[model samples]
Target: MSTSSNRQMKLAAYVMAGPVSGHHGGWRYPSAQHDILDVRFYQNIGRLLEDGKFDMMFVPDIQALPRRLGDSLASQLTHGALGALRLDPMLVLTAIAASTQRLGVAATISTSYFAPFHIARSLATLDHLSAGRAAWNIVTSFQDAEARNFGLKEQLSRDERYDRADEFVEVACKLWDSWHDDALMWDRATPQFADPSRVAPIDHHGRWFDVEGPLNVSRPPQGRPVFVQAGASERGKDFAAKWAEVIFVTHSSLASAQAFYQDIKERARSFGRDPDQVNVLLGMVPVVGETESIAKDKQALLDDLCDPEAGLSTLSYQLDVDLSPFPQDQVLPDLEVGGVQGHYREVAELTRKQNLSLREIGKRYGVGPLRDFNGTGGEVAGRMQEWFDARACDGFMVQMPYLPGGIEDFVRLVVPELQTRKVFRADYTGTTLREHLGLDRPAH
Candidate 1:
């Protein structure tokens, strides 16, 4: 395979601490582990990803259960839907960080419900504990169920949420910058603990938040944890352009992925940021096997195991619309949604392009996004190399169909092929997450 620019692909394992990662039927797989609450389960995953030389392990979080369909959680609970059960991503990532030495740990923490100081402190602590291998996935949660958990009647409008998020990040950056690198002084002769002149309060006053103070923790080893985001809306893209170092995105085709990649890079440049510094990672679901037929059978099995209602329920929650009212045989009508606009757009495109009914979409959604990388290791690696060469993405955020096994398969099969092709690293060369991504640490 012909190589692209000496730039190596950056791979991150998109994961969740729930039974379901992306595929609703994943937990039902015979080899899938159900011991999600066990830290060892996550640690094993960490070691597996590190063993494969993945750049990072990313964990996405949801604070509440799926209740958008008929205002009931029965379908979700019964089928073990995506959001049926979730643990705190930060805590899960910490466990992973403890077991793995080189793999970076990224945790999703919503800006909507958390104060700037709280998030800054938590991420800084994680960065320190992990010895600089830390990243924060910034999210402005769109679910009303999530808002309700924090005593709000409903979520703010999309624009409003983005506005708040912009300010929220501003405050967080200030807090993270509160402590200078030279603030800590352990001079035994002078008996001085820290240099007071080097440390100062942020004294940030914004429309959304007002915080006065320096972070209690010392400056993180990374200076600041790497910022990750998955915003596909126009406003969301702008926010990402301004702040996100790693951009996670989902696309159904190479053309779509290319469009987003170019658009985001342009947006980053417009924001006075180097486009190359912003890594755009496309979400990919890899169903691999020793042979193409075996891979097909594995995919078919996942499809057979899927509960359509579980997919619809999770979809409903994502779109903030009840799918139960829509006829299963009819095409989903275009409607203004208050939830994840990007996801809604993807679903709508699928319906329009294929003229698919709600039932058809549900079954497909339950199996997760249809991927081009479902074959033998060589085939999967070839397709990935194609995307990388085409500049469709900086790399991929691999979403597994099943837990440990799914990741285990890719690591064993595809990783070696990519390494041989010289499009991916054979080993980690950096300690900090920023260094892994080739991003410079922000100046305090």
Candidate 2:
């Protein structure tokens, strides 16, 4: 890791292998790519991000379609809201790994739905395939729709889910450490395979799981895949502090970001971890243009194309409440929700501060995170540098307003400005995701 005086920003591309990103209207954008199902589309993305010197390309996933609002999938399907048509993230990331050399590939996996052995084996295999460029974004499946798909009637409560997740990750780490790094023996003259004594069973018995024996896969190249997380609630923050290496987060202002940054770092210190190793990345949508006015015009065009119902549908699924019955023009009422309490708090705070109606909030949410940095390439880089210098974030998770075009614009425009300022990498100096992010590899 670089010293405090010369720390560089870590950049990651937050993406989905689906029509929608954070913006519901993205797919309709004329310049956006439509062949999402093709593996070549993702391979091209991997190559583009690698060429841009991005640290990683992280893909978020959902297990089920959005059917929370009005008990129908029409709004999500018709408008291409997120989760309407999603592919398995791991499969898409595996394809990207085959085509790229240095770009890190991360896929979201839920601890609530999957067994520890399954996650450990899958990520171990990915680490080997990518040559140590794999990361796992940990999430406790928030939506009830996801729970139903896993043979449960509803999702677990917030605290309960985290409790299980804490155990879940523990078991996975144990499984990964079951085999010693030097266990393998490729020498044919010895006429022996891996040393049996060096590989032993991890007799783990916990409240959430009971797994015995070693993982079927060998130890990963990184020892363990780098941990990525985006938990914002009180319990969630504690979990991130304990386990997350690359922390993805969203905030409406610099002050909020700074507060979160400080809190998480302090929490990590309390957990006996080095704060520098916990990299906090703020989620940002950068709409680039040659001039500031052109950028505003581009953002306006995106907002105009948005379908309000689509945003409400996504919000409903996220909050686990049917927002369709509420009056659109009236102030949004506060309601206790079970899904993603942090998201609910953010949206609720926005409504209170702005006196925004349900209709206004929905429209804003559809456009994705608040576009706090939208201008010319130099202007956008200036804002990013300000945040990095102020310790508001270690970096930015570049969320695209549209696919290839949005990514292309940032790489062509803002990246050069950042490189010129020497605040971001001009070229990759490391091979693994851990190295790219300046994190220490975990010992087995």
Candidate 3:
């Protein structure tokens, strides 16, 4: 492994904490968390990730159930397929904050649906409560179920949604920045707890929203907790380049990932931002064990649990198209979806490359391996080092196929191998998440 002394790879624990995280039947796996409703399980996972020297533990939330192909909620629950995705990530994240000293806990909240003020206040509160170890995963929701909940008849056009999101972010940034670092005077004699000059109103009037600030909360610890974006479409990339400090990405191959990494960094530079400041983390699944054979078997067991029916149902909502209406053997239809432009392109490209049928695509959905790995701990770590050396990504969002077991295996096995190579941290050297991720804290 080409280990650079200055450039250590960042790693994060990615979890959904719904019914199944990555695998369709992951919750059914013997070692996976069957009683996921327990609060202790969530806390343990966060603490474990901190023990492993992870940058952050992210809870990717969905405001609504994954409804597809007219699949009833009962059917989904019965099959343990996307049973429920609406748990408030903020509540869980706060609990995680209390337990772990260094682990950054993040929540996925939709920019498309939420009022900018709400996002600003809640995330700021988290940053304060966590003592700066907080992150916000910005997502433009792709679910029609989410749109319905927001009282929208249908999703906005792609251009419109991005436009609104751009302004949404603008509003949020204004709110976050409204309270200056020195705003909290805390002078008992003067009885002026805050300096009015330092705290000013950002009367922002934009295309999507109108907001008058000074936020109720003071400046967040990291000055608008580490901004994370997970969009990869052309417009999404532009948005990320402008504001995202960390980007979560999905690419089918290393070359594509590398291409994406280079492009996004270049885009950031074009926007007058330091390219190196933008960390691109690829989403990947690592099925690991002590030996290669053991690892492959572990992966196979997860793959075998693929339920095509549930997969198809899940795909419909993901692709934002009703795949249930299409014939099983028919070539996957090209739908002009208004959501998740990047994912839509990925799926569209998949069909275009191989002329895959709906059934095949559904199977592929059940098996979502974005730059997956199956090998011994050393081998898995080796692959990761190669990708890092190749400049495919700054690090990885290690997507767990099943709970606790997959995490325990990776931390126990792969982390030691990585530490031996001196490519990953053995113990946290920084207190805040930005420091751990090698990012400079935003100046006041």
Candidate 4:
């Protein structure tokens, strides 16, 4: 293997505490704690990532619970834990920030439901509170359960949501820029607070939203909390190309990942943006143990704990079609269902490509690799390296298979191996998330 330090590659971890991720049943594990409402658990996870020298921990949030119809709590209890039972991502980030230093905290807050001013202040405060170590995962949630709670009779279509998000982001950026570099002047003797000249109103008026004037807070330490966007639809890619500093994506194969990566970078270039400005990150789940065999054994323990029926229910919501309607051995129909985008298509594509049976698909649902690649230490690291070498991803956005245990093992086992191989870093040399990701901090 050629020994060259790949300084540009970045890595981040995702945390969703419960039985499993999108799959419904994994949380019932004795080791798994469904009560993610606990602040201490999240705080510990934050501490662990910092110790592991990981770039950041991104917490994905949904505005509402979507699966009450497909799978009741009984089904949810079996397969995975939904967002309804978890701590508000913002609160969790605050808890995590208080307990650690250096680890960047990023939370998903939807653009569809929130106003530009509200979103701007909340994220800016987090950036200031975390001392510039903050990021925002810009998402327009897909589930309709989110819409009802926000008082909408129906969910906005994906394209409309993206349109709103584009404007939301633009307004947010203008608001962040309202306060210039030296807006605050706390001269002890003089006591003239802020320079009024530096403060300017954005005066934004768009079709989706209208906001007037400067944000209540000043510009964050990193200028704007590192802009991260996650959506894999065509409209999503365009939005990401225009505004995203980091793009979170899902792909079943290396070819798919590379294709998506190349397309997005090309799109970014067409917009007169540096391709390097958009970091492509593949979402993956890692199951680790002392050895590959041990890891398999550990995964078996998790699998044994899984409820296949619950897994199916969760899959139903993700695929947005009731799997129970189809026979166990019947092939899935190639229906043109359009509401949900991104990961929904990804899951459907994987099932069709692999020709997986209903039972087979359910079994693998919340098991080991929830979204992307899954394996033991050596195998996982090898696959990760393959993606990196193929230019499929700039890094991996690791989603935990369980609570602290899932993330704990990867940090302890796989990280050391990857570091020794020189494929991953041994220490974090920078302070802010942008610095850690090797992106230049914007000056605005």
Each candidate structure's TM-score, on Cα atoms with residue i matched to residue i, is: 0.98, 0.98, 0.94, 0.92
Off by over 4 Å in 2: 1-4
- Candidate 3 segments whose C-alpha is farther than 4 A from its true place: 1-5, 352-356
Clashing pairs in 4: 19-26, 19-27, 24-79, 24-80, 25-78, 25-79, 25-80, 26-79
10 residues in a row with least lDDT, candidate 4: 17-26
Candidate 4 C-alpha error for residue 81, in Å:
3.6
Better structure of 1 and 4 per TM-score: 1
Give the TM-score (vs. native) of candidate 2.
0.98
What is candidate 3's lDDT per residue for 1-444, written digit by digit as tens?
A: 223666788998887777766677677777887667777888999988988989999888876776666655643655566535546789989999999899998898888888999999999999999999989888887767778877888777666777888888889888989999889988999899999999988999877898998899999988878888988668889989998888998776788788898899899999999888898898877788888888888777887777676667776777676677789898877687755666666677778877888787766666674635668889889999999888999888898778888889889988999899888888989888888887777776
Q: Candidate 3 at 266: error in angstroms?
A: 1.3
Model 1: runs farther than 4 Å from truth?
A: 1-3
Reference-based lDDT, residue 51, model 2: 87
> How accurate locally is residue 213 in candidate 3, as Cα lDDT from 0 to 100?
87
> What would the per-residue lDDT of candidate 2 be over residues 147-215, giving only the tens digit for each residue?
999999988988999999999999999998999998898779987788888898999998889999699
With a 3 Å backbone cut-off (N, CA, C), the pairs that clash in candidate 2 are none
Clashing pairs in 1: none
Question: What's model 1's lDDT at 186?
Answer: 97
lDDT of candidates 1 onward, in order = 0.89, 0.90, 0.81, 0.75
